[model samples]
Target: MEGEEVGIRHQTDGGQKTTYGATGSRPSSGDERTAQIAGTSDSAPVAATDDGTSGLKSAQGVPAGPSTSYSDAVGLSSRRKKAIFLCLALNSTFVMICIAVLLPFFPQQAAKKDPSDSGDVQGASAIGFIFSITPLAQFFGALFVGRIIPKTGPKMVLMIGGVLVAGVISLFGFVNDIDDWADFLVICYALRFVQGIAGAMNITATFAVLVGLFPNNVSLVAGTIRAFNGVGFAAGPVMAGALYDAGGFTLPFLVHGGIMFAGTIWLFFTLPGDAEVGTGKKGNKMFKDSFTIPWSFVWCMTMFICGTTIGMLDPNLSPFLEDEFGLSATEIGLVYLVFAGTVAASAPVTGYLGDRYINPNKLQPPSMLVLCLGLVLLGPWAETNLTSKLWRSIISLVLVSIGFSSGITLATPGILNAMHKAGYEDTLELHSNLGGTVTALWAAGLTIGPTVGTTVVSAIGFPKTNAIFSIPVLCVATLGLAVGAAYALKDLYYRQRTGTYSLERQRLLPSKDQSTAM
Candidate 1:
């Protein structure tokens, strides 16, 4: 019976297989011969039924299907997927923490000179460069990493990025001893640029992985990820301040680098190796296709605005606190904690709403409105009198966090939903590309925001800059609300008329097809 498929064969009457003798005669019933012939060896293969039950067979005796236990053991379970997602979220949080950790220390770092030399140190422009270079480098990082990911996959990209980030951040500790200001500036700028590239790769790859893992719940998952980032942003400054207080400039960088390195190692082992290049067309065709969805453009613009608003804070906020309130570094960090803490708290809530209750298309106006409110609160309209500074800062931070949670956080899900509705296949490649483009636009805004805010603050002062920024933001929000409402009404009309409503269907169909439908 070597290589023979032996199992119980069921007949139409639901009877088991009957044994036949060598001469093709059936053994007589109630005879030992019949019992001996019917008894098969223990090694005989057991077949499965259609319901995944074992010890069952078809008429022809072929294995019915795979067993349920075997399937459960081999396939990834829901619990395991969530665990992996949590790990990735933690990794993202670490990345954001690394970015924000230096914000509180920038002025001190900028002013430091070699102890042996008593010369004029670098100025605010040097500080500006330090703050802005990372985002500028990220622009290129996002652009190239998007294309490279299709070949290397996310796991390897993250591994490489993690190493680069770890190495570059560790180098920050060494810059403290340099005597020459020019050398110090060059070194800091170079390290930041490399770190930006590494960060871009890590973020781009991580997002692609998340989207690939959960196509149906992109918004919710994206929100969870953002929430983790907010956690990092919330924790980073405080940690950095404490580390700096304990061990000076070197300690924070070294400790963070070690943590990043460890996370990278964890990713290498835990992350699955299923990422592959996208099947969709790239370059001009991809770009052209992205624009086919109206919401894509809106998401990009919204991201840009989000970046700008955040960027405006990076260089200006710390200095503003110092000048206006004379707060110490640790105290300033607490102020930052309010903003990041709020963002962390609100992101998941908004994300959940976006997925379950709020329509992705409708998120833009509300998000913009919230952002405008934050901007206005922080502007000249607020009383900057000494007694009110504390409350003003707290209220403004809370509003900004809420605004960002609703507006910027929804951008990813909104973009993804729009792509899906537009007939694009939900593939890692498409998500990667779109994510990269959006990230790049956001980075561009970040790059512009600090520089613009710095220049504008220098000319018109801080209060005027906030007021000026709010004007355009309010305008954009108003326009977005009108457009979103119009689209909603149009969809309602089509649904009533055709009994099946899809914006993509309406626009994509030819003129002749549309006339017949009407």
Candidate 2:
């Protein structure tokens, strides 16, 4: 141990020689003097000499990497970041899977339990409402979760949500009569609402930590996580179907609920401390005072229009498949599995492109253009009653769904970059736990889309209603493309006019991790 001393020597730019010294003893030895010398030799520690390392840890207690001050909470290594991603990805998968697994059982259970129910009760519309309501609750819940998460903490929120989902789902198993069913439904719906709120919070917290841990690769990480989201979507209904057939209605819900419950326990026990707290008053102030639309109203309006379009399309797809092809509930669930499945599949590739090749803002137009084509294909199919026509339409709609999902996936990165370019970081807290706010905005559009689409379809019939709805999609696509093009032209014009894009100097330094890697 006496011969293990390590001293590092370097020459300063000032033409002076300097020697950096550290004992070779591992920080774990609890030697205070050795840690002080080694830790301060590199990055500045977060706490000053007074507050930091109160115990005077030895070199053996110090880590070989950066100091504690430099390390993020949970000590996110690149490896741990990957772990976080996997956990979050599993979280996404589990949530969607839980929702999907119940679809197959619901119809058969409904029919067997109540033969006196009307066609409306048997209709996919009721299921659609059940499906739509949770997301609808999520939309509203996102607006407030930013304030709530910090107060309650992510672990608590996840735990509560998981318990609620489990309890409500278990309750679904015990209801013996139709008279008490309304109460069961209400409890389930309320729990779903709570789940939405917690989901939004968890997503934001997890993403924020990842961003901090891997700032440069945020988009790539997001894309990768989204790819897993597809896996969940694809796997959910299949598992649900298998379980429902083999185990019965009660089993699937209980099993799915149990998985969620397990994930909640994992978070409570394993989630790193000091990763992030919550979106606080400062975040609220930043949003209120600094958040702005980079392209005037263009981006906001585009999201609003697209959100509605997709929301309507998502909810109605089940019914559409049923009415068009005379498909059963199981068949309709398969269709949803395909549609969402496609979206999940394409997210990673599109996200990769958005992060690496294309400028983020530039991603909007191409995605939107493709989505418009997909919507157009859906129009004629809306009126077709032939089973073959329905299958063909399903194929075409899958194509469209892929395009639209790609567009939706691309929008987040694009908006983020646009905001960054416009210097809205301080105000929006865009890189922090403000993901819920962004999600909320998108959800608002979705909420409007379904309400309007449903109302219009009810009034005018699906075919005519779709034809009218297509107009907004096209217009929004056109406007979004135009705005993106304008930004490109403006950047070009500025380069031509001046040697530099702007006279402003760069103040922010790259992070130490990135800097050292470079």
Candidate 3:
């Protein structure tokens, strides 16, 4: 016991260095003192009060979080960042394709499977039930994926997710072989639910990985991935249509599924090292530090609005274009392409600015305001008694798409940035948890959106509904922007005086038992 070694904790606050030995033995003991608090030096221990330990702890007797600034916390290599970005791009570029490829192709195919369904009414209904299973499953699955990420590690979770999604999708091609309607519905629904859970896993882990790897350049990285997401969504129908034309219904699923599998393969080789993504001390915890900081809710609300609006348009927009503007299905699809293009084009630019110059609060609110204006214009100036013009509609659609892109890009990083100021640990699990919170809400919004779009539009008409939706967005954006600005100023003032943006919260830090290795 005399010659045995013990760990000692050190902290420097206001030019004072305090030391607390784990065994309460003085440095005069024949033992070694390891300087392990973010590599701070083994400076001479000070003559301290409270047994040299009470000030270093919290009321709960848990060890305090680090006092070091975020910039000094950790460093990641460029090679690792590239590996992460590749994994994200591949995953994003293919998952949506796998998901969306069925949209333009499945209902008619399923309807034909039933001999009595000549009119295809029951087919449409049954197919809708099948398609809806995935998102609904994902809604619940998002709640648990974060907890799993910290245990299984992100890379493995991602691998399993990718495999599940790809496997389910590839198996879709075999559905044509089944003739009985009941059996077909059962198989389709089962596959969809499996893929849905897989999607939840993939998205949650991908976001968590991004947060840990590219904390400094989050906006650009997120924006780039989002760009790929839009591309995949836009390309899915086009690819499906083309492949169906060439190789029939089975080809589209097989091709898209194969693409997703390729992404999974690339991810296996590229991601450098695998570990449980986060501190993951808590699973599916929503807003882990909301009491300390409340910004995550604001972004969550923004995303909910965005998702609902997207869902709203998906059900109503094409018909509106056809009936109101006399556009054909092809033209309407081109308009949809334009919308996706705007999102893809603007996301990275907006994200780059968010990282370098603009703050998330300032960026998101204004972008939503732009969306509000676009919606109003799309609504024929919202009760101004003028008919909506085609050009104006296109412009409005572009604005709406860009706003959606900006809000999505802001959601995760915006929440995480606010948390860091409160001194949340930068663990993969932490990112996954926050990511799960926003993701679940977004899925909820989408789930509710179609119903709202149909009912609201029918009740008050499109123009009034668009105008009404703009009001809540405007109110939320104004409040969020104001709060963001206030915090920005507060952070600036805090940094100018104390030399750090963080309050350096102490309760959230790792316990001494957890740090004996480092």
Candidate 4:
């Protein structure tokens, strides 16, 4: 390292290395730390970098600064890269489609099961409960992934979860056949719960693998996967609508189950096998770091909002469209194309901008505002004749879709950068922990969004519920904008005047202890 100081290093071989970044030499043990080992506490941090030959490239001359691309410092063979991408990308596409297949029809069926029938509140609340149950299971399942990933490794967990989820998807087909409301409700809830566990497992594992494989290009990786995920979102409705017309309620789920099973088998053949890869006695810390990490809350809020962008619509939106527009299930599913299609296109751009130009955090607030605008129009609460216009609904869906996908795509990469700045090492364990934590928060949002959206819609109707929800999102967007602007200015000052910047301060300047430390 020349003409710079290193703030953090994640080398493969574990060797004593020269430092770069803010100071020409390393800081005292008290002033700095690296990534937390799996079970380790704040003590016993790993310092220095490894040789270039391992999966990660050597960082011998590179500086850990703002301008540096993390992916550029990491390396992978072409074959391995292909295997990782194909296995994970296909998995994401199929999983999202499977998760989405029910959105167009299930709420309508649950609405019918409503015993009170006293308007929409009671039914909406019950239906919301049914819809929310799956993500609720996923919230816990994320925690479960943290504990198991080290012992069984992510590969086994991904496989098991995939197979199990496929079974749940297959079994859900039987629910519509039950005539009894109690049995139908019970079966639906049970299947959703199981599905949530499977989903959490699959998603968490997938994220861990991506993080491990592309530690440097996290933003790009997240963006690419999200693009595929958006495609699944776009396709799910079309597939469901067509399948329902072909075989009624049973066919969509059965087809989804088959697709999921096939994807799982592909993964089993593709992903690498795992040995005992636990960090140490502190292996539990990898799971616990979700709480201990200083900026975990920041990522949590963004991740939650990302999830709600999709979730808030799931419990009630389809039925609202049906009642307001006189649309059939198939038609309702087609309407979803507006939302999912926009997501498919915009998510990748959000990621690219975050990586190539502005900070990922800066991208979020604007997208949130876009979402707020969409929600307002979705309700058509403008108090005019156009309030119920179908075109207004389409435009609103598109905006909401953009916000949803961008929010998710930005959060993962942003957290990785933030963690690196906060003095956490960019290691596989660290990435795995982050994946689990973020997934947990995302699950929480998905659970809460539907439950709250339904309950509120019951009270004020969907239009009013959407209108009111927009208020909070608007507030958050405003705050994020102010904060993001301040940081952007700070970075500009550091880069232009001082000539270089890392997370903490300008690397062109030296720390007070540089004399003694060097």
Please tell me which predicted candidate would have the highest lDDT against the true structure. Answer: 3
Q: Which candidate do you rate higher for TM-score, 2 or 3? A: 3
Q: What's model 3's lDDT at 32?
A: 24
Which stretches in model 1 have alpha-carbon errors above 4 Å?
1-75, 114-122, 322-329, 382-389, 492-499, 503-518
lDDT for 193 (candidate 4) = 88
lDDT string for model 1 (1-518, tens) is 32222221212122333211111222233222112123233323455334322342333343423211111211345776776787888888888888877866755766765333334334656656886899898888997887767556667888998999888888887888887878888998999999999989988888877776665467787778888888887788778988999989889999999999999888877775532233323544555655566676677677787888888876677777778788897788788878877887788788788766667667777777777777666634446443436577668768877876776778888776667566554444566777677678778989999888888988977766777777667766776777677777888888999898665544333355334554
Write the candidate numbers in order of decreasing TM-score: 3, 1, 4, 2
lDDT of each: 0.68, 0.56, 0.71, 0.68
TM-score of 3: 0.79
Error of 4 at 194 (Å): 1.4
lDDT minimum window of 10 residues, candidate 2:
9-18
Top model number, TM-score: 3
Per-residue C-alpha lDDT of model 2 across residues 330-438, encoded as one tens digit per residue: 7776777677777777777777776656654566666666666666566463354433366566776776666666655555555555555444432113444355555
lDDT of 3 by residue, 33-84 (tens): 2222232333323221222222233223333433221112222357766766
